[model samples]
Target: MNLESPKVNVTKSPQEVFNFLEDIKNFKSLMPENISKFEVLDDDKFLFALKGMPEIVLKKKEVIPPNKIVLGAAGGKLDFSLIGNIVETADGNSEVQLEFAGDFNPMMAMMIKGPITKFIETLATNMPKAI
Candidate 1:
């Protein structure tokens, strides 16, 4: 399954946004308010538990300077990647795009589609405020 969030324009520059996301420890600021627990395991890894979901560990997978950042589940049931693409605007601001891809069985896909879609959309929408 693949999900893409709407492009969002943020007041911060692309480098600023990319720098913020490059650090896994700053992810807590982007999480939903319902998150129950958050822990930073290292500079590149973190664990977080949502209100009703099992704790998930995420690790930074790749970085493309001020252009993109990729993250994946460290050791979890779900095999997924979350990618952030940043484009610097002429006005010195930034446009960000969020993409999520995961492998799942049909039943699991049906069960999670809605929540997962909403989660990604929420993340994209709130990212501007987070920076």
Candidate 2:
């Protein structure tokens, strides 16, 4: 099944939005209790634990300045990727989009997608406040 990605609007500039989301440490604050063992690998990669269900190790895959981020999780029935992007709006607002894609059983998809979407929305909305 195709996963639905959510877009969130934030009252922040593109540069500001980019810098904030690029840091792995920020992810810890956005997760619900299921996640544990969040770690930053060097300056580019991140390793973390997925909470509940079929727990797995998640790694940051790609980082593009002021625009895109990609994360992947593996080690279980679910092998998925989480992508996020931030763009500047004309009126000085920022638009952030979070997308999920993978090959997983329907049951696993149904269970994890919603919470991940919600987490992305919450992160995009509150990220500015953090900076």
Candidate 3:
């Protein structure tokens, strides 16, 4: 299923915002309670464990610093992709668009949709603060 996640407007510049959001070590601090731990194994890869949600061992599929980051993973029959976009506003502020899409296992999909959405919203709102 395709999900439209929240987009948050941050006061920081695009580069600042992007750096904060892309750093995996900061993820647990930015994300909501649902995300218990988010760890970065490298510059472009990470492993995340979610409480009461479908856990993902994500690998960076693409990265174009200060602008876009995409992570992908396979869970059983499901293929998941998460796209994070950081845009520089006209006023030089930053805006983040987080999109999560995947074909998921029936049971796991149903269980994770809401939590995942919450995760995105939390990330959008707190990423700038974390920076």
Residue 2 CA displacement from its true place in model 1, Å = 0.4
Please identify which of the two predictions, 1 or 2, would achieve the higher lDDT against the true structure.
Answer: 1
lDDT of 3 by residue, 87-127 (tens): 89999998888889887778978987987777777767776
Question: What's the true lDDT of residue 67 in model 2?
Answer: 84
Which candidate would rank higher by TM-score, 2 or 3?
Answer: 3
Give the clashing residue pairs of candidate 3, or none: none
Where is model 1 more than 4 Å wrong at Cα? none
Ranking of predictions according to lDDT: 1, 3, 2
Q: Give the poorly placed runs of model 2, Cα more than 4 Å off.
A: 33-37, 47-51, 74-77
Instruction: Compare candidates 1 and 2 on TM-score and give the better one.
Output: 1
TM-score: model 3 vs. ground truth: 0.79
lDDT of each: 0.90, 0.68, 0.75
TM-score of each: 0.95, 0.71, 0.79
- Superposing all C-alpha atoms, what RMSD in Å does each candidate have to the true structure? 1.0, 3.0, 2.5
Q: Which one wins by lDDT: 1 or 3?
A: 1
Q: Top TM-score: which candidate number?
A: 1
How many pairs in model 3 have backbone atoms within 3 A of each other, for residues 3 or more apart or on separate chains, i.e. clashes? 0
